[model samples]
Target chain A: MIQNLTTVWRFRHFLLALVRLDLRLRYRRSILGVGWSLLNPIAMTIVFALVFSKILGGDDLTRYVPHLLIGLAVWGFLKESATAGSRAFLQSESYIRQSPLPLGIYPLRVVLGQAIHSTIAIAVAVVVTLVYQPYQPEPTDPLAILSIVPGLILMFLVAWSAATIFAFVNVYFQDTQHLLEVAAQLLFFLTPIIYTAGKLVGKAWWWLELNPVQIILELIRTPLMKGHPPTADRLLAGLYLAVVMITLAAGTAAWLRKRVIFHL
Target chain B: MAKIALTDVSLTFTVHQRKRVTLKEYLIQTVVHRRSISTAVSVHALAGVNLSLRDGDRLGVIGHNGAGKSTLLKLLAGIYPPTVGTREVEGKICSLFDISLGFEPEATGWDNISYRAFLQGESPASLRGKMDGIAAFTELGSFLDVPVRHYSAGMMMRLAFSIATAIEPEVLLIDEVLAVGDMAFQEKAQARMKEMMGSARIMVLVAHDLKTIRKMCNRAIWMQQGRVMGAGPTDEVVDAYIASVTRTAAA
Candidate 1:
């Protein structure tokens, strides 16, 4: 574990380069460039808000739009990143075969790139909410500010582990790629991004507790949107999951690092 | 003192030949560990091959396909850990085993170059400064801004080879990469490699072009069926390897 960390630290620049490469490649040929980062989520939020506000008639959705946007941005980042990153090693196998750098940097780069894209999404949410929604500044909500940084960190860890673990599975089973897409889609709906846990306050509430994404959603949402101080439980849960996933991912990567070449 | 040392190094891989695709059979196989003798077998890619290369020694590797020539290059580059025994390498090693392997098909030629270089351990700062030189060397010219996916196989190899040799690695591990590109480009690349050799570094060249090997390498190792058949002066090893191939063909 220490060895992995040391290796990642040494190749920190490669991770940054990967993030830059991802961003450039993302909007390279597009007319909108980085603006699409915001446009994508806002567009989805508009569709959701219009449907929920007009057809469903939910209570004052003015706040809910920004809330939903933030949640979706975070969740979308996690979902798409894991999906893309799961194939990180496979995709970069050529680079791995040619270059002499440490292998972990590729997965880490995948996470960092997604984190940057997600940050752009979050910035869009902030802009839309502050300008149009009349959101009053809540200076005392340190959690809100903390959310910006830690949310990215947590998302990165989740993405790193998800992509790397899937890399292992992808090597052994090519069909795992389709399975991953299905799994990500299911996870998106299962997580309480579209609605609150209170809405499901019934026999099916246990479903929320069982979801690993619940803590992740709450981790970002509690500090960013809800403006609630990060409760000890939420912090502990986030930290615990991050530690566990990182260890598992690192262990799997180490075990599969050299072996993956043969399989390829 | 900078050298690559392989001591009793062996690499074994499990070869699974899928004969039929059935979920029930797959589950049963997973649970029961039942296997038909024909479905799968274990194969050794490299079997306890030991070698040592000191600085300034150009070692050539000649082998038939699947005879572990590429595996040896990968192990030397530290891309693979030996399944059994130890391999130690000391120096900055750069490998051109898979040219254009890491390239993003969607990215521009220049963009791919930087990304590939950064992956090869060139600092971003260095890559930024060296981008123009790499582009010039490849003569990719106006195509630098074009997406790499549109490049032909030869174009891809040109770009890959140019970007790989841009860095001055102390130990270079190449597998059939020098055979890439047009004759002019090949000459330029060979000249660059010759210049690089003057820096007194080790190079492991894996190729079937015996003439080029004899020209570039001082010593050569012939491998057959995952074991070293012969190792000595380049001409002698090449002669023996050719004789063995002739004997096998005659029989």
Candidate 2:
């Protein structure tokens, strides 16, 4: 494990270059360029706010817009990373066949690339929060900035591990790419993105507890949306999930690293 | 010193007949019959291949298509581990099986160069000085500024070959990549390869052109059906391989 980390660190520039390549290729020849990253979530949030505010029968636009924006941005990050990272290996099959670099870098490249877009979306969310401060839930504590540190770290760790696992599985089982697409759509509605988790009162709330995404989402949403650090329970949940995902990612890579080249 | 040694190395590829099976189909198949939905066929790509190389060995590999020539190079390059035997390699190996393997067409030639080098484990800090030399070698001066998508196939191959050969590797495994560019550039590339071979501790060249192999390699191995048929001086192996091919043709 230490050796793997060191190898990845040595090739950090490679990872950064791949991420830059991904971002550049994604928006290449487009007039808006990377502006699309910020525009996408903003557009989604507007549509969701319009539809959900009417369904919930609420005129409080500011309160729900920020909530929906932040949640959607986080969800978008997870969805893109998971889907893109799963195909990272297949996409770089040529490089894998020719180069001798560590195989793990492909998944890292996908996560980092999506992380950049996610960061842009989060920045837009912060701007929305400030603009709609009067109507939205005001941040209660300045210490919330500190909470974002662990929050962002945990968020990235979970996404990275999940992407790595998906990348490995997708190599052998090409169905994983399509499976993740459907799963991401299902997970979006299931997670408390469009609606607030607080609305579910009784046994239904336990459903949220069962979702690992809920804890990962709260890691960011609690500090960013609620203006406070995540509860100790949420933090512990994120930590536990991170441990399990990281172990699984490492185990899968070790077990399948040699064989993945053949599948590719 | 660069070295590679394989003791009874073998590789098998377990290919699934149906690569993509939906989750629903898989689950139903598993729950209903407790069996896999897709059948897997295992192909023995390489079998009981034993070889050893040390410093100053310019080894040539000649074989018919699908005879595991590329697999041997991949095993030496660390792209694939031996399925059965023990394999050990000590070197900063560079394998050039496909020159245009990693080029992002939407990226500029400058970026592609850096990207390819980085994939070969070359750090940006270390590659900065070498970039100019590589660009000069490609002769794609102003063209390097534009995206690689606009470059012609030969132009792209030039860029790829230049970047791939920028650094003198401790061990170099090449697969018929020397037949690149126009005649002038091919001669230049051959000269550059010779210079690289002079510095490289070990070199493995896999090519179908017997004359090229005999010219460049001191020793050669002929593979037939995933096993080494003959191994010895390049001239002897080439002569025997050619004799057998022509004899079969005459028959």
Candidate 3:
């Protein structure tokens, strides 16, 4: 599946075209236009902060607002990418059933689009964080911008693989659509997107440490938010986890390549 | 020479059929038969069929629906890998299996054409430049800016046919798509197809129109019940296939 990375490069126009459609049609009738991208996260953040931090006996989470915003921005993109990627082919069955593309590329496009949307949110988050608490993030934290490159790459892989795998699975199983949704919902809480590892005290923290999403976001957030470089060891561990997810996704793509047309 | 080669290529599909599930049956199937399940059938869509094509060969395939004509075209186009035997082809191939396969109906004519052209294998930058040309060919005029779903079926076929043929692939596989358009569009499409044949390309056409096949194709293959009944020059092959069908119906 990876052999054709350059093939997709050749279809750069198709990818850009899809990205244009995704952004354009996403809120066509809605009045807000692209402003909705910024509005959604800000609204969600305010609601979560008000509901969880204030209404519940939640601790002072003012510092956690930026943290939560960052996590949500990343998670929202990842989740949306996964959701879109998995359904890309099924939604575009009219196209895939006829045209000759690698098929794996469609899901990758969904992820890239989602990542672009996430980037917008990240930009919004950066501005909002600085405005709310200018003194907190260190000057060195701008180096964290470098983390975007790796984050984007990993996000693309996850989206590509999920889309490719699901494109086949949903066609064959039909029930897999529901199964994946349930699984995605479960994975949402397992990852420390809403709360931090620091919040979980002591011996019980092992599960949080084991969560790959935690490691991935930390690799991203530490450099950008704290102005500190993520340790070499943590980066390696995140890369290892990413490799496993990508391999599993590729395996599904190889298995499904021939089978996809049958379903179509 | 630009060509497509199929050496004893075949494809079989395994389909799993489930017991029709009511709410109760669904629960039982999920809970009890989750692992030990037994309800499926296998279908063989294509049997070993050898064929080869050189540039300028417009080979027509005629058969009943599901007679593997489309399957053969797909294999030649490299959309489906053959389950057995080798299928090889040289030069770029474009397939028009369905008239509206690549268009996003909700997208504007300009955006969808650019996207569809690229998916058909044109370079992105080139597709960008060719967008106007594609739209102009559609004859949709200013309506080209509107979403495609608003267009009638004839209009959609015109747009799809225009974008597909615009790329001028070295090998072109076309299903029975031209039948959908109006007479004028059909004439235009036929002319475009004839123009394409004059170039260095192999054309594999699958159609129910025997007259059109006779007019356009140099060679023809007639398929029946997943087997080839006759293969030769267009008139000879069509006559043989008709006689066999007549005999079968009489019997």
Candidate 4:
């Protein structure tokens, strides 16, 4: 596994080139360019804040806006990585056939692209939180900024692992992407994205901690929405999940590395 | 020093005959029909082949269709892992296989050049020195600024051939004769290929044209159905291969 990672690192320039090519091709054609990527989450945040604020009771832009924006951004990266990464190998079939590029770089290329788009959305969320405080909430805590660095690192790891697994799995079964789409939709509702986790307090509240994505989301969302860093339990839980996912990703790569070219 | 040693190496390819059935179709087919259809076709592309090459050896591979000539070149290039046995190769391997197929249509000719060079293991720092030479070889001129999607098939072939041949490899693997682009460009490409082969420490080429193989290679192997049927001095192997063909024809 370490050797596999070294191989990928050796081809880091090629991986970066692939990511650059994807980003360039994506934005070069449209006049709106990156504004299009920003538009979807921004528009979705506004719509969700308006509708969900009523359901959760009262006009709480401070709480709802940041929660909705950050939640949507995180979910967007996670979902896009899996969906797009499902075909990452197939997409690079030409390169795969020609040279011995580490297959992991294909999903890394996709995950990096989605992460960039999501990071932009997260930046928007942070900006809105600072600029649009509806309550007497002074979240000028520098620790919130420091805390997010770790959270972003953890988020990237999870996204990379998921994308790697999906890329390999989809090579064997084309239905993996379709199934992931359905699972994403189901998980979107199951995980409290638009809805608040505080609402589920006192009944099955442990479920939130049990779900590491929810924990990672809280690690990301707490400072923006609640003006404080996430609790220690949430940080540990997120770390544990990241490690688990990375191990799974490593295992998948080891098992599928030699055989995937045949499948392709 | 460039060296390649294969000890009873074999490669098997499992090709999926059809798209794998989803869970729904699979259940209906297995549970309801009480029989499952085999979906994979296993091809023994290479079987227990052993060979060695030292520095300055130019080996040519000749084979009929489905006889694994391209597969052997790819195997040497490390594109496909041997299913069994051991392959010990010490060198930087540069391969020219399907070189024209991997370019990004949305990218400009210059962008394609860099990326293709990158794929061939050329760092940007190294590519800087070779960039002008590659571009000049293409003769695309102002077309390098334009997206490759706009270029003609012949133009794309020129760009691909130019970028692919830019590298100075320790071990070179060529799949078939790369006679690409228009007649003028083809001659230039042929000359460049000859130059690349001459400069490389060791080279393995796969080609159907026996005359070209005999001219270019010092040693040769004749492959048929994934095994080496004949191997030796180029002249002897070519004579044996030709004799086999003619004898079969007479029979």
On DockQ, the leading prediction is 4
lDDT string for model 3 (B1-251, tens) is 68877888778876657522233345587788885344557777778788888877889999989898987887787777888889889988777766676688789777778787777667766776777778787888988889888988888888888887788678878888466488887888888877876563788889898898898899999986556777889999989878877999999
For candidate 1, lDDT tens digit of each residue in B122-231? 77777878988899999989998998989988889889888888888888887884667889988898888777665638989899889989998999999987899899
When sorted by TM-score, best at the front, the candidate numbers are 4, 2, 3, 1
Error of 3 at A144 (Å): 5.0
Report clash pairs, candidate 3: A85-A163, A141-A227
TM-score (all chains, Cα) for each model = 0.86, 0.90, 0.89, 0.95
Model 3 residue A41 lDDT score: 83
Error of 2 at A114 (Å): 1.3
Question: Model 4 over residues A5-118: C-alpha lDDT tens digits?
Answer: 898887777888878889988888799898878899999987887776766564477767877887888889888988998889989988888888778888999999998877
Worst 10 residues of 1 chain A by lDDT: A134-143
- CAPRI class of candidate 4: medium
What 10-residue stretch in candidate 3 chain A is worst by lDDT? A134-143
Regions more than 4 Å wrong, model 3: A51-62, A131-148, A175-177, B15-31, B34-39, B249-251
Which regions of candidate 4 fall more than 4 Å away from where they truly are? Answer: A54-59, A132-140, A201-203, B27-34
Tell me candidate 3's interface RMSD: 4.0
DockQ (model 2, Cα): 0.55
Sliding window of 10 residues with minimal summed lDDT for model 2 chain B: B16-25
Q: Give DockQ per model, in order.
A: 0.41, 0.55, 0.46, 0.62
Q: What are the runs in model 2 whose C-alpha is more than 4 Å off? A: A59-62, A130-140, B16-19, B24-36, B209-215, B230-251
TM-score of 4: 0.95
In angstroms, give how far residue B175 of model 3 lies from its true place.
2.5
Residue by residue across A1-264, what tens digits does model 1's lDDT show? Answer: 677678677667756766787788888888989888888788888888888778888646866777788778888887877777767777777767665455667677777777787888877766655544433345455435465566557767877887788777777666676777888788777776776566776787677655767867776666555455457777777778788888888888778776676666
lDDT of 3 by residue, A1-59 (tens): 55667777887787788887887788689898777877878888888888878878564
